[model samples]
Target: MKVVLINPPHTAIGSRIPDDHLPPLGLLCIGGPLIDAGFAVALIDADLSDMPLNRIVEEAANREPDVVMLGHSGSSSAHATVVALCGALKQRLSDLIIVYGGVHPTYHWDEILRDSPCIDIIVRGEGEQTVVDLMRTLKAQGDLHAVRGIAFRDPQDSAKVVETPAAYMIRNLDEHRIGWELIDHSSYSYWGGKRAVVLQFSRGCPYLCNYCGQRGYWTQWRHRDPVKLAREIGRLHREHGVELINFADELPTGSRRMWRTFLEALIAENVPVLLVGSTRAGDIVRDADILHLYRQAGVIRFLLGIEAYSEATLTQIRKGASVHEDRQAIQLMRQHGIISMATYVVGFEEERDVDLWRSLRHLLRYDPDQIQLLYLTPHRWTPFYKTAEHRQVIQTDTRRWDYKHQVLATRHMPPWRLFLWFKSIELILQLRPKALYRLLGHPDAVFRQSMRWYSEMGRRTWLREVFEFMFKTVRVREGQSLKTFLGPTLEAREYALEKAKPANSARRIIPLTESR
Candidate 1:
């Protein structure tokens, strides 16, 4: 069977930031299982390749795949591109089966099935085993209804939705296959200009921060066996010659037992690799030894979601910890000689301009190695979504939903002004090279950090950007003129809209594997 897996072009939301990061690791995970089942598999990371929609369709038509599989990160706007691409594929090859999978499909499967007639199956939850089972069924001409964790449209009516029972999560990690050969390491790099290859040590997040869909999706934390994870890391380095790894798991620091063992395994393997990715704040402090291990295990940096400084806001968001903890975590990482990248959300509900300033002041208190300020995104099916719906706070369109563009108007502040505020602050941050240098000074640190910033920013290009956004753009907030944009609303606006939908539809195929 010939199967083509695609990471659809993501122009709708992620395009604002121009760096084409790593290929969709989700698709790569599924690719292994399909290949193991004797299916001819090809992966097209359209997001990285920048392939035109028509060109993608034409290429698949040329391949004449038995099954044309497309994957997405569940951004509704981006999903539209996937839908359009799938529709085009179906038009070109009517007999070809089309499948979709990812975060959006797990919760919104019924809606996706109802809306997208082009998609044949929606694989809910993890893709490794589910997708393999799907391909096997197609190969044997078996009943599609028997496949677990799949939702499909009723053929007889084409109006109703049918759902299979939940697919049991895979517990034994060794049974799963990681297909590294499908990816060409030379083709990928991290969004921030590191030549990075990625891996997942665990699946599922246990925390219930209201702003996140991760905890909601997996519902329970499940980790890959430590030995298997270490072996795979060794394999990625040895076989692929890839030097950098981003552990794209929900939280690599989640397990004391698993993380410690995995670290020891990697140490024993003696592979020199630079690892980076997101980790929770509280978890970092709780596991200081794990942080030490991460440094030894080649973890150069970690991006932690601090979210907010106000305890009231933190409690409102159900972050399970405090803002002080967020700072402590960064300090701990710094102490352990790991660079701390702090990510915060601004413009959450009831957040005024004053509140934004407070948060920014709070953030600067840590003197983070790097700071990423993002607008709060109220994605579909999250607790934030329900709350936004109840408050009548959702934004209306594509422009407003942009992560860079503030979309929602609060009772106190206007949305566009909030956007300008964030842009202005971002501009200042971009331009304050001297101020940043002073704050981040260590002779080697200053030199290496500046080079990295310059490399990622295209040699003072970020400085140029600061001048343009700051000088050219005029922002009006509640009809008030300000010298610059504000910061508290810089991140925590709960009414924020998503650039893409994360809705999961029926007929998505998950990857599966049984043979070791």
Candidate 2:
């Protein structure tokens, strides 16, 4: 059997930087199983390729595969693009079997199947196993109902949804292959021109942050073998010319002892790749004793999720970390000479100008080497969705949900005013003297050049987004795409904060360490 896996191009114009693109780990992971299962597989990373949908469709059709699978790493925002890509492909090759899988697709299967005739199957959660199973079943012309972890419309009765049993999660990470061989290392980079590839030390998060869909998707927390993972990074650096490793894990630092061991192994190998990923602020402060180990292990940057400064807002979102922790995390990262990138989210239902001011003050006080201001992305499965589903979504165009764009209509401000305030905060924070000095006047050439590259990217993207909001009709309130969206929001009660993974409460993998 032949298979084609595609990572659809991003919908938002400013969301991608060509040189800094990372390989689609989700697509690659699924590709791993397809190869081992003896299927002819071809990989297409549309975002990095910068290919238009029409071109992507043309290329996939040329492959003439038995199945064409589409998945994404950061999926909620890219749902619409995948749908359109599927539709276009279906028009060209009416007999083609199209499969869409991701966080957004998993939950929105009913709607997608009903509205879009193009998508034939949805490999619902943890797609690595599902993809392998789905492909095998289709090749043998077996009943799809026998394949677990899939949602497809009944062939005989279209009104009914055939949701098979959930796919069992891969417990021993070493067992599942990661399709590193499928990626072209020359296509990706980070921190300027350093060649990069995406890797994962672990999967899922132990913490319960209300707004996150990653946690729900991953089901539970688990880590790859420390020694094996370290060796893989070293090998990629030496053989594949991968100089930077962008981690796809939600939280790799869950276990202090294990994480420390992993770092020591990487440092022992002496790989100089720039390692980067997002982790909770608490982990940064908690790992203070071994701070140097992170730098020695080539972790040049840590994006701490400092979602908010106010205790009330933090509590409302169940962020699980206090403001003091956020500040101390930044300080610790700076002390170790590792760049601290703090992410602050806006667009909570109750947020106002006063909240933005408070956040700005906090950012200045924290003195992070970099800060990213993201709008709230309330994915359907997340707890935040219940609170936001009924509210007016101004940027209803599915692609604009990329944390960069404001989505929900605010209670205190109109769409235009919110956009203006949002853009103003970025200008004030990033254009200040200290930031400018670091980018332009730093003594270290490497630091200055890297900072300049990143700052320029941010500046250009910010400007693009501002212009988009002002002139792009795609984001206008009247131009919303969700006209069929009716009232009653999905009811989501909080599962046991300490237990019960979403959907599959029967089977859950408790992380060896959640205490740290």
Candidate 3:
């Protein structure tokens, strides 16, 4: 069977630079089983190529693949776009077997397939084994109902039926190739010309954040062998010339001993790579030495889920951290000279207007290197999703799935207040001299360059008006190409739209299973 794996275009900084990004790990993990089974396979990283839907459709049509698999991440816009992509492809190519797999699909599996006839199957939970098994069954012309971890529609009847394909746990990390051959070494970078790649050292999450869908899948956490993970990073740097690597995991620092060992190995290898990913703030603080070792291992930045400031709100949201602990972690990351990208949530059910200000105030006080404020989204299958679904939290348009651009209905605060508050905070942060200096590094030279970029956008006033109009309406103009608004003028606007793209562009082996 000929299979095509894709990483669709996503929202990110739109600077043109040489790509030295990681390959799609999820696609390749699934691809690994197929390759062993003697199947023809190819990967299309639309993220790396900046390919539009039409281009994606064109390429898939030309290849005439038996199965087309696409991956997505947490962002709603990206998932919706993936659904649209699958729908469009199925429309053009009736014989094609389109599959959707990712974090979003596991809980929303039936919803995705039922909503769109274009999607024939959705591989729930981990996809590596499920996808391979699916292909094997399809190749042998067997009944799909027999597959375990995958869910597909009932073709014989109008009513949709689902199936869970058998699950295969990957206990041996070294057994898989890591799909190094599938990666195109030349095309990846991060946050303005920083050469970046990602390596996952583990899978699954042990704790449940009410907003997270992970709880619906794996019940506990799992770790890759420390030695093997370290070796993979060393190999990428020594053989592939990788300069920066983001260890993409639910928590890269999940296991303290394993994480420390991996860091020690990186230090020993003397590989100059910037390591970045999400980590439990408490883990870094509890094991300060491990963090020091991380700094030595070129650990640079990490995203922390300090989702709320109110203790009641935190407990309500199940963030699993006290205010004191969260603060300590932020301070510790600072002491370690590691850049902290803190994420805060507004629009929670129990949150008040005063609470929103207090959270913002706390953010300003901590003043991490950067902060991202997200209107709480109850993605499907999450506890929050289930609760919010019944309470009228669903936003008006699916386009609002771009959480940055639109807040669907909120639990307490009006959607407009949430939007205005975030917008105000972003503008204020951008205007801060210290923030600007950090953003551009060198003031005079970079400031002029920044001005030029803004000027270019101002020149495209009509386009800018269209974008602002869309934000106002929370509806995209009929036949509007989102690409035109991807850069500076539409910076915040596009962030939500483009972020809809999946993250597998940087690392080839992370399947939709892990990311979604």
Candidate 4:
């Protein structure tokens, strides 16, 4: 069988503001297994150049592959583009098997299959092993119903959707190698032109933050062989001329002992590559003693999920971290010379003018090296979706569902006013004297350059967002409630963790036509 994997272009501001791009780790992961299974596999990263739909279609047509798999890390926001790409590809190659996978399609499989005739199959949850099984089944012209972890149109009734049993999570992440050979190393870079790639040390998070879409999708926490991953990173740096690695794990430091071991192993490699990734604040504070090893291991920055400041809000969201830990983590990272990026999320709760002011004040108090303000984007499969089900949805367009854009409306303020507050908080946090001083005058040249690079990207993104919001974007004044718009929640039907339990103990799969 022949296969082609494509990373569709995304419209998120972060995707467009930077000059460099990272390899699509998910597609690369799936590619590896397919290649090892003796399939003719190729990768077309449209995101590398933000290729147009016509060009992407043309490129896939040239490949003449039997199957084309599509996925994106920014799944929710990039979904519409995937649909359009699938349609164009189907038009060009009618016999092509169009497979779509990602967080968005995993839970919304029924809707996607029913609405988009171009898509032949939806690979739910993890795609690595499932995709391989699917390919083998297709090769032998066997029934797709025998393949686990997939959803497709029923053979008897095209209008009906059939979801096979969920695929078991990969017990060991090292079972499949990443198809790094699928892409040109020189084409991808991060942090202002340093050759870079996205790698994962672990999968899933142990802590359950209610709004988290990743935790349920990943099923449970699992890590790769620490020494093996370190060796791989070293090889990429030495052989491929890669200088930076962005960890794609939701919680790389979920296990302190494992994380520390990985740090020590990477340090042993003596590679000079820079590292950046997100982790919980409590984990940083827990690893305060070995943080120097983190610096030595090339961890220049860690984005702590300081999603909220108030203790009550933290508890409500089950963030599992207190405000004190959040502040202490920032201090510890600074003391160890590792940059800390506090990710403060807005819209977890209804916020008024005073609440926004309070959030800004708290952020100033934390005094992290960087700050990323994101809106809470509730996914249908998450527990948080039920909490937000009745709230009015201001932005109906799925393209803007990225956390950068506000989806749910607040009773206290209009969309314009809310956007202004969000922009103001971001501007104040980034342009504050403390932040500017470090961006311009930090003693370490590497840290200084990193800060400046981020500042420049943020500046362009800020301006573009302001202009777009004022003119290009549209928001409904009196939109349908979230429940009315997205229909009943699918949390029960799609959560991977629930599906992993014993058959008798697991919740029964809800029928497709049943109302929640």
The CA lDDT of each predicted structure is: 0.67, 0.77, 0.64, 0.89
Candidate 4 has its poorest 10 consecutive residues by lDDT at 503-512
Candidate 4 at 16: error in angstroms? 1.1
lDDT per residue as tens, model 2, 1-516: 788899988866554643577778888888898899999999888888678999998898889977889988668678778888999998988888999987777766666777787889987777777788888888889988777778787777776666666667767788878887787888777767789888888988888888887786777788998988999989988998888888888899998888999999998888777788888889988889998899888777788888888888789888899989989988888777777788888877557788777878889998887878888877656777666666666765666778887776677877777777777877787888887887788775656666787788887787778777778746555432222342233324122122222554232222212111
| lDDT: the better of candidates 1 and 2 | 2
What is the alpha-carbon lDDT of model 1 when measured against the actual structure? 0.67
lDDT of 1 at 339: 71
At residue 73, candidate 2 shows an lDDT of 62
Write one digit per residue (lDDT tens) for candidate 3, span 1-516: 889888887643221122334556677677777777777888888877678899998988888799898885533556767877887888888899888887666555555665677888877666766777788899999977777667776656546455543344555555665555666675766433455566778766666677765544554466788877777778888887777776668876778888888888878887877777888878877887666787788877788888877788778878787877777887887677677777776656545577667766787766666666666654544556444444342334554454444434544666556656765665554456755555466344433343333334323432333356345555322322212221111111110111122433221122222222
Structural similarity to truth (TM-score) of each candidate: 0.84, 0.91, 0.80, 0.97
Model 4 stretches with alpha carbons more than 4 Å out: 497-516
Report the number of backbone clashes for model 4. Answer: 0
lDDT of 4 at 297: 94
Comparing 3 and 4 on TM-score, the stronger one: 4
Which stretches of candidate 3 lie above 4 Å from their native place? 10-23, 74-76, 155-162, 165-168, 350-353, 390-394, 410-414, 427-516
Say which prediction, candidate 2 or candidate 4, comes out ahead on lDDT: 4
Candidate 4, residues 46-110, lDDT tens digits: the string is: 98888999999999888899999999999988999999999999999999999999899988887
How far in Å is the alpha carbon of 144 misplaced in model 4? 1.4
Give the range where candidate 1 is weakest over 10 consecutive residues by summed lDDT. Answer: 481-490
> What ranges in model 2 sit over 4 Å off?
441-446, 473-516
